[model samples]
Target: MNTIFLLNKTKDPTLSEWYERKINDELRALGIKDVHCKAVSSEPMALEITHPLVLICSSSILRDTYSYQSAEQVYAPHAKILAIIVHEKVKFFRHRFTNLQFSPLRFIYNPHRMPLRELIFHLLSQLDIDLEVRR
Candidate 1:
């Protein structure tokens, strides 16, 4: 099964929990039984995950906590990395992450602006997962 590792380092714990619930709920609604979604706060735990993975974390997590060099050491090329950048910081984050060697690093600006379904679709698409392939 495909696994989505959400590396939440957001300021609001409630918002983080809500995001996790939304992703899992949406996956079920989409009949995507083969994919599993989980939220992780530890960087070591996040790095240890090697399944068909999708990472969701905030810009602050990337910028202030983890560096691209450190991430490149642990992150596989096939893994789809998504950064949730605050609305005002999108430009800075875009400029920073865009130049990385990673091919498909997606950025979600102001996540609260979009519906949960839209977020789920975008994330699942990045993994190139076939929802029909059930376990």
Candidate 2:
């Protein structure tokens, strides 16, 4: 089973909780298991995480807070990072994740207010292995 990690750097704990619940809930609705979350408030976390668990980052990482360095370090020749960006905030994606030396990182942009199912489908399709594969 592939382990998926949900990492959010948002300052608000409430938002973190909401995101976890929403993402996990949607994953369940899609019949996906082995998906989980671990919130991190600091950079360099990429160094500690193992592979097979896709990293799901929040929009806050595009800003000055732990965004650049985290993205850089995680962009190792073998690292995989998926960024969820809001379309209105597309400007932030510029030259941000360029140094990634591994398989192409995945990205899915919604209104940030779209239904959880929409984001879940987009995420699953990118991995190329759906819930059925895990089962």
Candidate 3:
């Protein structure tokens, strides 16, 4: 089965939990049973993440470079990653520099610009996961 690792290493606990639940609920509602979604606050040391789809859902991830680096070290070199910008308060300079550090891995979603459901669908499509939406 395909797996999704939702990484949220921010200071906000509630936001982390909310993202976890929301993503899981959205995937469940989509009738996507083949993919397993797991949320983690920090780098998972115990679990062996085999080329899973990773989602970085933290507002301050750009500010905390260590977390990003740690994640890079943990996941497979070819693993697909998507960073979701939960907040837009990151300074211009910081955002630019931090983005440079996150080379190759692009920020795919900004809640202010697009809905989470849209992002999810886009990701699923990219993975070639075909499923009929249940009304």
Candidate 4:
């Protein structure tokens, strides 16, 4: 089974719920029956290293003392980690430490500047899901 872990450390309940629902709906629509999409508000005890993980890169997560350590725990050889920029002012992941810490994750999606549909498409594609027969 494929798994998607959305790590959202921010306090915005409304945005978090919307992101989880929309992503889950899109994955299901793409025929991912055995997939698990979860929105986690804090660092998890353990994460499946092989699964794809989406990190909600916001000001809060960046400034958190444990964010770096938490991100390290999520890193794995086969894991596909994506950072989504939610802050309007953060046009890019240019923070000195952020660039170094999250540099391994090449896929960065900025919903504030780009299309949400595009992010979904990229996410599904990264998971190696076939979108030809979308339901």
Clashing pairs in 2: none
- lDDT value for candidate 2? 0.49
Q: Candidates' lDDT values, in order?
A: 0.54, 0.49, 0.56, 0.57
Q: Point out the higher-scoring one by TM-score: 1 or 2.
A: 1
Which runs in model 1 stand beyond 4 Å of their true positions? 52-105, 131-135
TM-scores of the candidates are 0.58, 0.53, 0.60, 0.60
Clashing pairs in 1: none
lDDT of 2 by residue, 1-135 (tens): 554455444444455456667777777766777655444443466446664233444454445544335443544323455544333334545665522322233444445435556656655665676446332
Tens digits of lDDT, candidate 3, 71-90: 45534344456444344444
**Total residue pair clashes for candidate 2:** 0
Which one wins by lDDT: 2 or 3? 3
Question: After best superposition, candidate 2 residue 132: deviation in angstroms?
Answer: 6.3
Rank the candidate models, highest lDDT first.
4, 3, 1, 2
Model 1 lDDT tens row, 1-135: 777776654555555456567778878877888776777666676666665344444445445434434443434333436544242234455444332322234445355444556556666666777555232
Top-lDDT candidate index: 4
lDDT of 4 by residue, 1-135 (tens): 777777664556566567788878876676667665777554543254446767665554445463445354444334457545453455345544333234334445555556566667666677777647443
Between prediction 1 and prediction 4, which has the larger lDDT?
Answer: 4
Model 4 misplacement above 4 A: 28-36, 46-50, 59-80, 87-102, 133-135
